[model samples]
Target: MTTPQQPYQAPSAEAFLMGGGGAPTAKFPAFGTTVSGRVTERPTVEQQRDIKTGDKKFWSDGNPMMQLVVTVQTDQRDTSIEDDDGRRRLFVKGQIQKVIADAVRAVGAPGLEVGGILSVTYTHDGTPSGPGMSPPKQYTAQYTAAATAMLHASDPAAASPQYAAAPPQQYAPPAPAQQQYAPAPQQYAAPPAPAPAPVAQQHNPAVAALQAQQQAQAAAAPPPF
Candidate 1:
């Protein structure tokens, strides 16, 4: 009968990133929730493999993806934090998991081209060999200056002012060559006046006379007899 092997109690990537023992760790922030923590170290490939294989179990899956234990001295009210639930700090396990998944997707699997997974390792001991890079202690001044310039350029307000202040130089389109055609003379036409109404000919003069006589007689009569 084979005895069950004792579970490994190796230091967690988080613990290592937080600095072995006694050192404080940074906080990372999560979307929607008010949790902030610094990712002291990202999980390495070997570490991930071990965790999946049950060789390691540093954190519980159901817990927040972006979870980090409170530092010995974490400020819950810091402006960097999203919410102030009164805890030393907020841990967003879900957001962290998404970020990890996205990273894996981007990096893709080993031996496949494109998208590289990020890992952090303080010390190398009995860990499986894989493509990995350690965290940088400090960045170069040139890189910092370049990054700052890029951020400044990315600002809408800053970019707007630069564009507004220096409008693009206008380049007037060349005038089309004028044709040599002669000018046409202007001609005006006067409108004709309306014709007067025509008077009836004397063919009905007798009838007109009779009608005039009747009118005169009627005018001469005062009231009905």
Candidate 2:
């Protein structure tokens, strides 16, 4: 039974991007609700892989393609997230996914490794299946950046211990261009410092006084005179 109501289309890729994944605007409510934490688990990706660019892909407006099982740290005894809420998102096609992917990569997050600080603003509204069908699998509200923030904020030591931008094995310090001169460990310790040289004594006042006394005694005897 098709009713004569305005079609409620899901937001577009351009819409998400333009909004900075929902940049908290005055018109829109402040992103008071945030994800429990940064997304630690990798994104679950689906849909026809590589269907050639430029072709239009199908979008199930209400169905979520990626169900992000995110960890929320809130102790909401009165809320739905008593256990864990999957901050799922939908990707109509590979292209649209790439659009968001590129944006995320540009964010320069330290790492997406689980247990990072991931927070976002999302609405609690559910998407209904169109006219005659049952509602598709429901999901957490559309997860989006509350403001212009990264979905993955890496912990401080992430870029250091876990992975560094520099080449050599991951242990290398973070200097990109020039080699860092870090003090070597026990095995590679630097050579020990040299000892100071012994200084010579130039002013012997006691020796000079003794010589003068002997000379004065010989002169007083005056044996030659």
Query: What is the clash count for each candidate, in the order shown?
Result: 12, 5
| Residue-by-residue lDDT tens digits, candidate 2, 125-145 | 334557766433221222234
Q: Pick out the ten consecutive residues of candidate 2 with the lowest summed lDDT.
A: 22-31
Per-candidate alpha-carbon RMSD to the true structure? 17.8, 23.1
Candidate 1 lDDT, tens digit per residue, 57-165?
2346332122333222223455554443223321213334344344435434322111121221122123334558433221110011223334665888665674544
Candidate 2: pairs in clash: 36-72, 37-118, 38-117, 38-118, 40-114
After superposing candidate 2, which stretches have Cα over 4 Å from the reference? 1-31, 46-103, 122-225
Among these predictions, the greatest lDDT belongs to 2
Residue 142 accuracy (lDDT) in model 1: 8
Assess the local accuracy of residue 103 in candidate 1 as a C-alpha lDDT between 0 and 100.
42
TM-score of each: 0.22, 0.24
Q: How many backbone clashes are present in model 2?
A: 5
